[model samples]
Target: MNQQYEEKLLNLIDRMVETASDDELFAGGYLRGHISLSAANCEMCGKTSVDAMNNAVENSLKETQSELNPADQLIVNAMWEKLRQEAYNK
Candidate 1:
């Protein structure tokens, strides 16, 4: 991710942590790792757009779906979408 989007994502996650429910908090932390790692992977592959970053994150999560229960996966996906909108949609 670009520095601006990276900072935005960090700020968004910080705010979410402050007000999120228990489930959201858990999903936030879990998704943070995926998001950051995905961004890094995208950068390494020369994919810098927000869409590329989002796709990497989603694909990573899908690859590890067995790690979370169905409901938790839903929560994580929802949070990811919300964060993506907040970060990229301005």
Candidate 2:
């Protein structure tokens, strides 16, 4: 995994968490951990930034319950979907 890409992903997620609404507890916590783990796990995986971030987000989402608000879910899902498509295209 590319260090710069990992940092990019973390920056995006950090921004997301910072701007999350009060009810987005799951999202904030999940993003925080995902950023940390992504930076750690993909430090040398040889994957592109998109792949690493998508994998990190999906993996984190999988581990937690999905009790999310529709709006929050919509935002997070959209972000992930866009990144997923970008990763596949790369």
Tens-place lDDT digits, model 2, residues 1-90: 455554554555456566756645455454556656765666656555655666776777656527566677766665656544543544
The count of residue-pair clashes in candidate 2 stands at: 1
Which one is best on TM-score? Answer: 1
* Error in Å for residue 33 of model 2: 0.9
TM-score of model number 2 = 0.48
Can you give the TM-score per candidate against the true fold? Answer: 0.90, 0.48
The ten-residue window of minimal lDDT in model 1 covers 1-10
Best by lDDT: 1
- lDDT per residue as tens, model 1, 13-90: 889777789988888899878877887888789988877877888899999999999999899888888888898877
Which run of 10 residues does model 2 get worst, by summed lDDT? 81-90
Q: Where does candidate 2 clash, by residue pair?
A: 1-46
TM-score between candidate 1 and the true structure:
0.90
